[model samples]
Target: MAEQRMPLPPLLLDGAEYHADPIRRALSALAGDRAGRFAPGDLAAAMGSDYTMTVTPGRASVPAPADGTGGVYLVESAAPVTLAVTPPHATRDRIDRLVAYVVPAQAGGTPGAWYLAVREGEPAASPVPPAVGAALVLYDLWVHSAASGRPIELSDMRLSGGQQMLAGGTLAGAERPATAPAGTVWTSTTTRQSWAYSGTAWRLLGVQDDTLASHALSGSRAWGPGVNEQAVDNLTFGPGRNGGLIELSAGVVHLSRPGRWALSMQAFSDDGTPGSSKVWLDWPGGPWLTRDLCDTRMRGGGFAGAGVLHQPISWTGVVTSDQALNAITIRGAFTPSTGGNRPSYMVWLYVDYLGR
Candidate 1:
């Protein structure tokens, strides 16, 4: 039995605005009596130009019939054209619903490429070509510079959605380094502060409360048969101020060096004798030199010399004497070097003694 061929539907080459007359005539000739009922091989042979048709999966390139209704159609134009097709409702397989063509190159003729995409079961107007929609959506796309890449110039680009352009790290807006300059010392701006550094430790500089206020020791003003018992008082000390007596009660005096020193006290005498007066000095933890007042005459009479005494003997061992009393007294001034480069010293006296 001979195979029966399906009848080709009519062809409606609608929207032929810019289609070449020769190409339309060629298509019409190929779709001769059954113009739309073209098989794959027949359609390929009919568009007799130098182009190729590649049918992807689920897609076919069949020919449209001549009649305008119930037949396939091809619309071609240059100034933007739309091709509309209405497939039968029963056409479920996408392969049976649409047709596309590629214009082939003729001898010595310039050939340009076009595009066609078909959606199944859509009405003639439903699948409008996306040129307008694509043009509208292109307004939303933008580009930005990455940290590792060169910065994008805003003047040469377009951006949407309030995007801001930032300069690159190599540009003037780069981040600054967070390091300090070498040899720059950090010191506090307070008078009561100190800066200290150890070779093996971190340097520290700050203000701390002076802790030698109520714990200092004083000395006797008068010499006596029972030892000079001095009632010393009225003292103030701090960092910049005098660091009062570091009371060493029979404590080990670490003598890193040795030199001439003196033991003196500011005092108030009540009975006008060296044995009957109140003296003020730091506590005695010294190998202090002694000053003899044997020939030193008393200024106010009655055996009491109301002044500081410079003891005139040098020693290095610790004096383990409990002869030091404490109200506000200091005992020794041991000069580590008698040659003038002495450690700085500051001393305070009782300018006003409000003893009750």
Candidate 2:
């Protein structure tokens, strides 16, 4: 039953079942069936599978199939040869199942010991491929116009689920394809970045801003605005006093997203009397006010004199979504050291993303 089921040609049974004619017919018939065609198993061999004919470095050949559709090869070569073939024009094509491989030689690095499959003819080369200790396989299954032999499509199931994107060489040396079909996905064997080909070029996925922003302000406004203290008036601000994130008019810092921030402020008692300066922050609906429970000041005044002293105060915390940062505000205040001396201060704010 096994022999009967084996794709042995009737003529081959009379001859040798291992002959090229039988195997070629078997492969053609198998592919033909898979491709919606009929392949005559007895057609006379029109091409030689044995390496009797020498195919040189820059040569090509289209082994004549019994029905001019497809055929097999028993190549004896040192390098891997590129095989290509075109299918007859129809509404569709399905010859992609065709495959190719190199048989390992017991004694490596010798010519005329490997099989190079044939198709639409050649323009491919493999120069002294490194000695493969084990049997290796390579395949070329291009379905082209039966009439013009033009490429229509391709896929690589080995990578990203049959993507038309492919690179040549080892993973370290592989280069991205020059062009790819729409929706084709490629994972760089070199960088391991998953790039999706969007017809124009490869685009990275899940990328976020990796920039850090900070702003610092110092000096004094002759007429103080209000304490809790400075009102960031505008949407955009000079990096000196209010980084663009601070709103000068409403004293609010509107951030598009929640982030970790470092808020610090300093006040100096420059006059010959003791004075105090303070800073604090509040969200529209926050977990807590950013200041000591008893004291809401960023800087406590020092003993005023020729030795002017500046006090520094700071706070660190995570801004959460519920406490929409856009609704938050920062304020500062200054108290006179003596009779009519004005208070002076400085502040710095830094925001950074933590990927949360």
Candidate 3:
């Protein structure tokens, strides 16, 4: 979808009528553009004079920082305000509260009434500050019961506004943000993995680890054991062999992510015969009902029998579909000039994710 631009105010003509509402609308449009460009959070002040909280004997104060200077969120505290800390009770060890700048509801239909608010916490051994709803938090304070006139370490607890931050829990438990701007990132706390918003949905981030699955071969299966010999077969990963990243059935692979990927297969046998084999993703229906050979091997002169041939072949392509998952099948063909028994040993399949 194309991004919509905010409309600018029209140029004034000579002897034209001017209205206050048009000026206000222009200013609002500008502010809205700023809000869209930058994330909502605290902005730094000049000369290190910011909304840092300072604690006194019985009070906590913030220095007078100019309004519209500390943050791009278009809300600020114009004057310095101090709140009195509650006297600690003997039963409770500490009292906690959160200091924040809150934008309040308009009075008598007038707008832009922002003020400082203290979200108070209940007295407890280790008191936690209450949630600062619709407020930009500045500091979290904990007052001790026993210590009077004690030095309180005040750390600037404001969030930076320059970049979009990540938020999520486990892969299964955590719910992704219902709506996020494209390129936004979210980390799964349980898996320690990250996902990115792809304008439409959350896509897993980074190069995914290779998924490896092997299929054990049974008795002797010759590549070509007859005259005018040509054999075609599907290389498969055994049931339950999927690495949880992908799903496999026979030779078809099911991928959930929509992006570029690198897929590979290795078919090895003990019998080394004078034969040639080609592997590819099934496309244009060739001899094996598959075209576009990814890799091919020709074994001309080798001892026939008793060794593993670990020649891995790979193919790289982009997979996209209207459906959530994509399905691709792999097929291979072997042609031998003379009749030779090439007993199947094992088939190893790999799918490596590149990225979106």
Candidate 4:
């Protein structure tokens, strides 16, 4: 009878001729299937300490896989072992490779096995390092041509991994990766923002704070009870803060990104009068027509004359523009009578961005 070559689940038949090859192949294939679940360079957690190296001391510590278990293949070291590295080349640069390799069994008592070694490479401007068949490259030691006594620096080594979900450090807008696998996250140090790739494009993550367009009161200017005008202030722009999506001018906040925004304000009035003070927000030509007028009235006799009255009001609504620009106008006035009266006033307007 021809013997089965590939591995399969072991099964027995009554009074059937039995051999060791089929059983061994089945068990080995099962184990290989399990090991394949992990990436090529994944370090087995329970096996031993992660393959770590000390550059200055030129030492390396590696954990051997127990019996049949290993990162990619079994290792020869019976237990955790350390290896000393040879000194760097005096006149040429090279890469020292730490690798785990498998050796097939020989004809004698020698058995198939796995072993770890630090293979030194030929020195050159860009040297091609040696590689064993199916070996797991644990780390790369970049040795530059240096004086004989110089210590190895941290910048001269790199730990190898099967994959990286995150890049080493925060990146700038220009430094952001041009292409990344889906689900990879890139953070920006300059904007303190992050984006996640979705296989097609990068999308912003987390809440974005609204721009502080303006916050001030029309000082020294008294209104005629119902006097209202555009809230004005000296505009200051933060470099690259809003990505030009929002801008602040004399008294108007420009919203170039179409989305919902929470509009809020506080108005104050005190003019030896006994009436109510009011403030309201509006974006005349945009989707958000008007916000509720907030009012504050003097409480009692002691608070009637020359007493300050301030009230805060807020509204969350959507603003849209086909041209990607919307100008929000913040207006304030003192309406003492049910009709109209005049007085000095203070108004504070705040705009916060809410997502689409």
TM-score of every prediction relative to native: 0.18, 0.31, 0.32, 0.33
Candidate 3 off by > 4 Å = 1-243, 283-291, 300-302, 305-309, 322-326, 342-345
Runs in model 1 deviating more than 4 A are 1-189, 197-233, 237-265, 270-328, 331-356
Looking at model 1, residue 120 earns an lDDT score of 30
In candidate 4, residue 151 scores what lDDT? 47
How many backbone clashes are present in model 3? Answer: 0
Q: Best by lDDT, which number?
A: 4
How accurate locally, in lDDT, is each candidate?
A: 0.26, 0.38, 0.46, 0.49
How high is the lDDT of residue 143 in model 3?
51
Candidate 1 lDDT over residue span 75-160, tens digit each: 33223223332323331211112233333344223443323433232223222222221110101111121322322111111112
**Candidate 3, after superposition: displacement of residue 158 in Å?**
42
- For each candidate in turn, give its C-alpha RMSD to the true structure in angstroms: 36.5, 20.4, 16.0, 16.0
- Put down candidate 4 lDDT per residue, 1-356, tens digits, no spaces: 88777544335766666654355445435334222212212332111123245321211222223342333332223345465566667787777776655544432244555555678778887866665345555556665676544443322122344322222223456456886655567866654556676556555555444443223322234556346443534333334343323545665676655567666666666665445545565555665333334444552123346556666777776765442254665555543433445565565655556677
Q: Report the Cα lDDT for candidate 4.
A: 0.49
Scored against the true structure, residue 157 in model 4 reaches a CA lDDT of 23
The pairs that clash in candidate 3 are none
Query: How do the residues 1-356 of candidate 3 rate in per-residue lDDT, one tens digit apiece?
Result: 99976464364756656643355445434443222212223332211123234332211112112322222233434344455555555555453444434232222333444455545567686677676544445555555554454433333454323222222222333555675655567765433446676557666555333333222211122443443322223444455443434444554555655666676766565555567655445534222224544556676455645233556667666766332254555545555546565445345566666656
For residues 1-356, write the lDDT of model 2, one tens digit per residue: 45456554465366555545455556534333221111111111121232111222211111232333344322323332334334334433333322223332332455223333333322222212122222212222344434544553333221222212222212222466766554455655533444455556554432222322444443333333233245433323435433222223443454434456555555444444344555444455654554231123333234445435555556566766455334645444556444344454343434433443
Error of 2 at 111 (Å): 69
